[model samples]
Each structure stands twice: as structure tokens, then as C-alpha cells.
Target: NGKEIPYDPSALRKIREHPCYSENASHKFGRMHLAVAPDCNIQCNYCIRDFDCVNENRPGVCSSVLSPEEAIVLVREVMSKDSYVKVIGSDIFPISHPSGTIVKSKDSYIKVIGIAGPGDPLANDVTFETLRMLKEEFPVPLKCLSTNGLMLPEYIDLLDEYGVSNITVTCNAIDPAIGEKIYSYVEWEGEKLHGRKAAERLLAQQMKGIEMAVEHKMAVKINTVLIPGINDHHVVDVAKKMGEMGVYTFNIIPVIPLYKFADIIPPTLSDKKAMHDACAPFVRQMRHCERCRADAIGKLGKDVQEEIYRNRGSL
Candidate 1:
């Protein structure tokens, strides 16, 4: 919300430049990502490996799945040469998402962030363990996770416990009725769940996740994918809920027609613009989103990246 203070760049810098970065920088590629976890608990109609999660017009997912040992060796090799390794966890965690490497090198100084690749973080316990291990062993400058919000509550404590101060949760529909029309099945506990019941449960958990975040005083950012017929009508409500719940900003993403919904057409730039305008009254609207790839080599929102770079240069 506008009333909420903007994110403190100084605070973020302290977290991103921790020992994790040093270890990753010692690797050969300068940056490396590994996905030890492959299972996903939810089936989103728009998620396809080859398109942007927010908008499907770009290159597909990039990043490899490596065991913890492989990741450590990769990071060490890359950082040894470039000394700026970015250790990324894509859809994998420690417990549910096992890793061969749990401990970070004392010199590991990498920027570690988690992306919701083929699944949601809230639905996976391995992801939680990965986060916990990272926090315990090598606290970095930033620890981020992307999710769909279903298991958000179950992990709010973990986020706080792990010192994860920044988070992004994707909320396509605030209205459960609308969500049912967009999502095909709800995957939970290895079962295919469906109907309004699934939608309701998902939405409720997402809302609770937000509430729990607010209670913990962590910065919350909501990413809403705008689907034309199904969830386009509910963006503002989503924004309002985020604002009221004390979220720092609202990233209104354009729907990417991928996977099961690949045949569906993406919204036009003008349509997205109009929707952005409509939702501006409720939360901070991100105007220059890049619709980054799943395994984006760079940052997520350009603005935040710019801030990071600027801060880094000054340091």
C-alpha cells in the first residue's frame, strides 16, 4: 500500500551480500542454479516450462537440477573464476526437495533466492528445509521464495524462523468461484483435487498466508496474473486485500497461456495497461515488469534490480 513505507534498499543490501555470495562467486560460471525438488502440488493452467510465468511471450525456463554436491561444486567452480555466483533454488528444497549440499562454505557469499518453477513452495517441505539450512549455515543478502499461496500459512513461521524478509506470492484470483474456472485441479498430498472445494481451500490458505505474514511484520508482495475471462474481474479485489493486509506492493502480472492453457491467447499490452490502471487505487503498481523467464539470469522486477545494482556500485 502507498501508506506502507517503501522497501529499504540498505536493509536488503546487508542481506544479499552475506557469506552465500562469496561461496557462489568462487564458482566458475559466476552464477549457478539447481533444482533438487521436482514435484509440484498444484496444477495451474497457465504454467508451461517454455514461457514466462507472468507473460508467455518470452524464452522458456532455464536452469539445471543438480544435487547439493553438484551445486556446491558448480558454484565453487563458477565463483572461483567470476567471484559473483548466484546460487538459485528452483522448485526444490531440502526436506521435500533434497539437496546433496546443505552447508555453505565459510567464504560462500552468494545471493540466494527461490523461484516457484514447476510447483509451489508452500506445498513442499523440502523447500522449507532448503531455506532453513541456507539461513542457518550461510545467511545471505536476500532469501526469496515465489508461491501460489496454498501452503503459505504452514510456512509463515518458517519464513520468519528462517529470516526470510522478502517474499512474492502469486494470486491469480481472489474470488474462489473465478479461480475454479481458471485452475483445473488442486494437487495436494499426491492426490488430484478439484471443484469449488479445491478453489476455496487454496484461496483460504493464500489469504491466511498474507495475514500471517502481516502478523510477523515481513514485507509482503503480491503477484497477480491477469487472465481475461476468468480472473480479470477480480484484480482490484486482490489488490485491495493485499493493501489492507499491509503488503508492500502489488505486481499485476499479465497471464501467460502455457501448458494446459497454451491454446489460449495472451492479453494485449493495451489490455494489461487498462487493467493496471484499474487496479492502481488499491496498491503500488509495478509499471515496468519484464515478464522474466522462469530461470531468469537477471533480477525479477527491473526496478528492484536497478536498486540492487546501484547499491552494489556504491558499496
Candidate 2:
């Protein structure tokens, strides 16, 4: 082990309360997501990365973009009214693109920190800065992000430097061949291309990322999107590899029908369960996934519906 990356103490406390906190929660952590960047570096066949806007109803699906200064104000205002607020990535850093989602806040209890955006945080330097700035100015106890691991080697050091212990890297395919089948094309450096080359490139990046996280002593987790016939078989390989790489947990999320990808079939109950079974031999699987909205507030589970009626707050 390199240096022991300390876990977020406060995060551990609120994790139970977050709707999406546990792997067995019927709801997601009632955190707020925001899109600091409207653009993205890479395009996945099944994603409309720019859909994170607050004005939208799809909680946990997307958050609206805002400037750094604007984000600060938004955080302050949200804090003034609500007791909990989380900052999720809606193309906020990790893309390594010039565009950034920077939020500087001094608030001590902003709740769980998250950064699952439309883009890959490893690809963007600004993403690291945003986190670093938060670590310095904010009393953020739980710092989290959802990344594609495109630039893991480049940013793993930064992750450790910023003391980020909780993280989720979306690994759709462990095999490049399967990856090519799932991703149509990627937009890199103003160039549009697809096929095996793209898949290979992405896989290589993510694999290395897993290694670095372990070496840095950071708790690692894997998020695999289970596309029906695409990478189902290879998902097992994904689990084994992540487990060997020291991944602490794994979340096998079924494909959500949305945007242009809406036409794509959603994962059947059996399919989702099968994927969970596949990963069961390796890491722990999140069992009670409610598939809550991107900006969902309050608790998870069907029993909590009545609570949704009780609470009318913005995420």
C-alpha cells in the first residue's frame, strides 16, 4: 500500500441516510446534482451527457450547469433552506476539457459530496481542482465522483493529493471488443471516431486507474452499466478484474432508457439479477437500487412515497 488514504468520517455518518448511500437502498442519497459544464469530451452510444439541469424533474439523472461563482451562491442559498445538499457532477470536471465545474464553498456541513457528471473526471484537470478547492474551503466529509477512468494515470495522484477516498468509475466493458460494440464513437480533441480503437483506448485507461487507486490506498468501486447483449458475459471479467485491483464495492447498474438511447431496451429483471449474480462472487453488489432520478430528494424505497409528499424541496 502506498499512503493510507483516510476515509471521510462525516460521510460514514450520513451514508445511511442518503437514499442512494448503500448498495441495498431502494432510494439514492438525497443529494443535489449540478452541471457546471454543458459540453462533454466523449460521447457514449447510450448517453446524453448534457442532461444535468436543476429545472428538470429527472432527479439523479441530471443537474443544470452553473459557473463557479454561481455555484457558490447556489450552495449558500440551498444551505440556507435545506439541511443537506450534495454537489454531483453534471459534466463538472474529470473531462480534462477546458470547460470546468468549479464550486468554492466554506460551508462545513454541505452533506455528502458527489461528482458523477456527463464527462470523465480523469480526463479533466479542472475536475481535480474543483475537488481540491472544495477540500480546502469546505468541510466536506464525503467526496465522491463517477468517472469513466480515461485519464486515471494522470489524475490518480491528484485524487490522493486531494484526499478523496470515495469514488465510482463507470466500467461498461472490461473487454475492448465488447466496448466497441457498446460505444458508437467518442469525441476526443475535436475528432470523432469509434470502433475497436476507441474501446481499447478507454479500457486501457480504466484498468490502469484501478491499479493506481489501490496503490494510493484509496477505496475503489466499480460501476458497470449492464447493456443487454453488449458486455453481459464480459461483465464477470469486469468484476474479477476490479476485485483483483482492490475494488471495495461494485454497482452493476442496468441501462436506463433515456435520451436518444431511450429506444434501446431497458434491462429486464432477470438480466439485472443475472448481472448482480455475476459480480456476487467478487465484490459486494448494491441490491436495492431504486433507479431514482438524478436530482431526487428525500429517502428511497416505495414506502417512502408518502414521505415524498411530505417533503417538497429542490435537489
Measured by TM-score, the strongest candidate is 2
Model 1's lDDT to the true fold?
0.57
Compose the digit string of candidate 1's lDDT tens values, residues 6-83: 766325442233211122222311112234344456667876533333421243544344444443343344334323
Instruction: List the RMSD of every prediction in angstroms.
Output: 10.7, 9.8
Worst 10 residues of 1 by lDDT: 23-32
lDDT of 2: 0.57
Error of 2 at 237 (Å): 1.8
TM-score per prediction, in order, is: 0.70, 0.71
Tell me the lDDT of model 2 at 111. Answer: 49
Compared with the true structure, all predictions reach lDDT values of 0.57, 0.57
